[model samples]
Target: MAFFGFKDIDKLSEVDMAIYRYIVDHDEQVPLMRVRDMAKGAHVSNSSVMRFIHKIGYNSFPEFKVSFKNENQDLMRSQQNILNIFTRDAFPHDIEKTIKLVAHLMLDADNIVFFGMGGSGAIAEYGARQAASLGFNSFAVKDPFYPLIAQLQNTSNNVIITLSVSGKTSEIVETLNNFVNSPDTILISVTGNIESPVARIGRYALTYNVPETRIHKYYDLTSQVPCVYIVDGLLMELHNQDIERQK
Candidate 1:
């Protein structure tokens, strides 16, 4: 089976999910298929296939194929590993409490600031955009200086979310440290390492642990997936809360 099956299908766009479904239904042929071949079978463009692979956390088609083969060789073991990875780390009961708390904070906050660097920075920007779409006043600060300034200017009604895969990025840690004693502003950290500096200092930390692999040494993948998933879950919960209040 393709490794993409391990991801949350609801997180995919309609077109991407359609392509993913096609691949899942044709699992027997997927290992032998090329990007172009998969696109043809799914009636999607080659670029669509490429995007789908990246969205599902693979850096490239070849990387995806190799992992798919290894995972499929021992499907039961692979599925269990995936289940443990997500359930134990990503969707644990504490994550629900964190999302609920974030939803409440966002609903009442005057502003929301998202901070990160590198791949985590990109995910931070995406999360900020998602929050804005959900009607929150949000800003994404990828630069270290901007977050420092934001922290200096924002009041207690502000909410800050920092994204760091390792939770030990120096700039992010320093930024969180600046807010360590702030009484009014709330800090939330989304990270892969709960014990890292940023997570330890934040008011609330959402942790998602993906097993380190040989592929990770060469390609920074899967780290963003859990972050994005947490952001989406928070947004969805906030939306639901809003609808309930309206009712």
Candidate 2:
């Protein structure tokens, strides 16, 4: 009686689904199995099992398995929780990963500018102010189409950090691609998928890897927190850098 079967269904490819299913079915008085044993049970290769764990938001098989056994709820509750975490939706793992990347990017970038549209755009603006306090020149590019032109006209050596949840926005994609050759313009994308169009064009992509369920449906602020927290992480890391520099 593993709790929920699986959520973030789209996040899991075919192999991940199979592996997860195998884990659920074998949980009661489960055998002590190595990765190889687990993979064999799942009808997947060992490498595939490990990859599947990461893809579905687990740091490792042991960590995932531990959580899988935490609750004593029935299979239905388990299934529901999976949905709640991934789709319906409370997604801690995705959010945590996003925060981690933002902190890293903030420390790494020479200068920071943010780009997004609609709600994500609003968040980018908020991120800019937050970053600015840390002595980084931060701007939220309002019009995705004209950012490159504006960047060319400005005389600062700064990187552009674009936030796109879906990574499919054509205008942002084009804007980022337009500046591919500019040494002054280093592109860092905070996007949800490694396979997204924006990730493809950016100089460096800090992928968020949101639950597939979060991406497929409409939600008010579920996805925004991941990106915002990323900015917050960046700000915190910047503070640390300042402390180090002052020492």
Candidate 3:
């Protein structure tokens, strides 16, 4: 996947993230947006917007706009490829089955805990927030040092969804290990590697099989677009249940 200049989105501040999300949500309109326009939309100053542009690896707004325009024009989102970047087959043949299974766990659970660290950690928060918006009692945990998970021990009605690119994040693997034998604890792992330790620990696993994208020896910037895709699928699956009930 072509990175957008920065190492990753990890270092982005809340203000930067606001701009980033605004740009993403308004992607088609971005090329035409002026700096002041972005500032207004993200509720930030014009200077803040400029800082975010550079922070993401662009020299200037015009440069970022050119690249963003080209990316939108060239990249096609499909099962075989995501954003024209990942080369591997990104979805399983039984994706519908996987979606249903995840939805089922969420529907049956009293609480859903989303866990990850770093980029995946942000995704964990997104998953939790999204799920809660759908009226599920969902919680997000990104801090490995947080000790509250002990409350989940041996609980059958709790679902722990772990997001990772490599699936070997020590914090995630360690947390999963802590619940290895609890019959009531359901584990669902979303990762780029299906055979990773986190996947092996899950009762259900969804792997995107995208080639790893790493940099600086420590950052796994693997396209998490797949993780977001899986989470969206699960949300839609549960949404379908709502649709069915209205019938």
Compose the digit string of candidate 1's lDDT tens values, residues 182-203. 7777898888888888888878
Best by TM-score: 3
TM-score for predicted model 1 compared with the true structure = 0.62
At residue 247, give the lDDT of candidate 3: 92
What's the C-alpha lDDT at position 57 in model 3?
76
Clashes of each: 0, 5, 1
- C-alpha lDDT of candidate 3 relative to the true structure: 0.83
Give the per-residue lDDT digits (tens) of candidate 3, residues 1-247: 2333345788889999899889878888999999999999999999999998887777888888888888766643333443476443678788779889789878878889999889888989998998899888898999987884576754568889999888888877887887778777788998888879998998899888776767998777777887888888888888787677669
User: Each candidate's TM vs. the true structure?
Assistant: 0.62, 0.54, 0.64
RMSD of each: 11.8, 16.9, 11.4
How well does candidate 1 score on lDDT at residue 220?
57
lDDT of each: 0.80, 0.69, 0.83
**Which scores higher on TM-score, 1 or 3?**
3
Query: What does the lDDT come to for candidate 1?
Result: 0.80
